[model samples]
Target: MCKAWDRNMYKLRFIISFQVQLIINFKLIAICSHQIFL
Candidate 1:
């Protein structure tokens, strides 16, 4: 049971970090597009 719980925690952390990276990437793209338009 403890091992299962630890695995789930790790998965959750991985997902959170992945989401943050995706958000940063999207923001960077948006900024680049805006600069191009300007």
Candidate 2:
């Protein structure tokens, strides 16, 4: 049972980090496009 909980926690952390990375990527792209338009 402890092992299963640990696995779940790891998966959750991975997913959270992935989402954060995606958001940062999108922000960078937006900034680049805005600069290009200006």
Q: Highest TM-score: which candidate?
A: 2
RMSD of each: 0.4, 0.3
Model 1 C-alpha lDDT per residue in residues 1-38, reported as the tens digit of each score = 99999999999999999999999999999999999999
Error of 2 at 16 (Å): 0.2
Number of colliding residue pairs in each model: 0, 0
Q: For residues 1-38, could you state the per-residue lDDT of candidate 2 as single tens digits?
A: 99999999999999999999999999999999999999
Q: Which ten residues in a row have the lowest lDDT in candidate 1?
A: 1-10
lDDT, candidate 2, equals: 1.00
**lDDT of all the models against the reference?**
1.00, 1.00
Candidate 1 Cα outliers beyond 4 Å, as residue runs: none
Return the TM-score for candidate 2, rounded to 2 decimals: 0.96
Instruction: Give all TM-scores, in the order shown.
Output: 0.94, 0.96
